[model samples]
Target: KEDYNRNRPHSSLGNITPNEFAMKIAMEKQAA
Candidate 1:
């Protein structure tokens, strides 16, 4: 449900939650 989408870690995303992956990507973009 909503909780899973917001907090579950996904294997495809290097075992990170969706929000974490998004933040990681954002930080990488900023660094670049």
Candidate 2:
């Protein structure tokens, strides 16, 4: 999880910061 959660480019968020990347996913799920 650490590898995916950090040290990598997040394609879904268009390569945003890792912490931001994870937050975006979380927010999207909560919205759903």
Candidate 3:
């Protein structure tokens, strides 16, 4: 269950993996 939650792509986040989405958001914040 934990693995699935961390590894799955989400439709709400543009179909990217959760980790990828998180990293993307973090990068955006750093850029700002």
Candidate 4:
């Protein structure tokens, strides 16, 4: 369960998952 939350890919964000999506968003914000 913990692994899934930390490493699983989600479908809503182009199949990137929650963790990945958050990181991507953070990076984009930083770039902006």
Choose the strongest candidate by TM-score.
1
Q: Write the per-residue lDDT of candidate 2 for residues 1-32, one digit (tens) a residue.
A: 78677867777769776887778889999999
lDDT of 1 at 21: 96
Off by over 4 Å in 1: none
Tens-digit per-residue lDDT, 1-32, candidate 1: 99888799999999999999999999999999
C-alpha lDDT (0 to 100) for residue 32 of candidate 4: 100
Model 1, TM vs. native: 0.84
Colliding residue pairs in candidate 4: 10-17
| TM-score of each model, in listed order | 0.84, 0.52, 0.82, 0.65
Q: Over the full model, what C-alpha lDDT does candidate 2 score relative to the true structure?
A: 0.79
lDDT against true structure, model 3: 0.92
The all-Cα superposition gives candidate 3 an RMSD in Å to the true structure of 0.7
Better of 2 and 3 by lDDT: 3
Q: Which stretches of candidate 2 lie over 4 Å from their true place?
A: 1-13
Write the residue-wise lDDT of candidate 3 on 1-32 in tens digits: 98897799999889998999999999999999
Query: Considering only N, C-alpha and C atoms within 3 Å, which residue pairs clash in candidate 3?
Result: none
Q: How do the candidates rank by lDDT, highest first?
A: 1, 3, 4, 2
Clashes of each: 0, 0, 0, 1
Stronger candidate by TM-score (2 vs 4): 4
Better candidate number, 2 or 3, judged by TM-score: 3
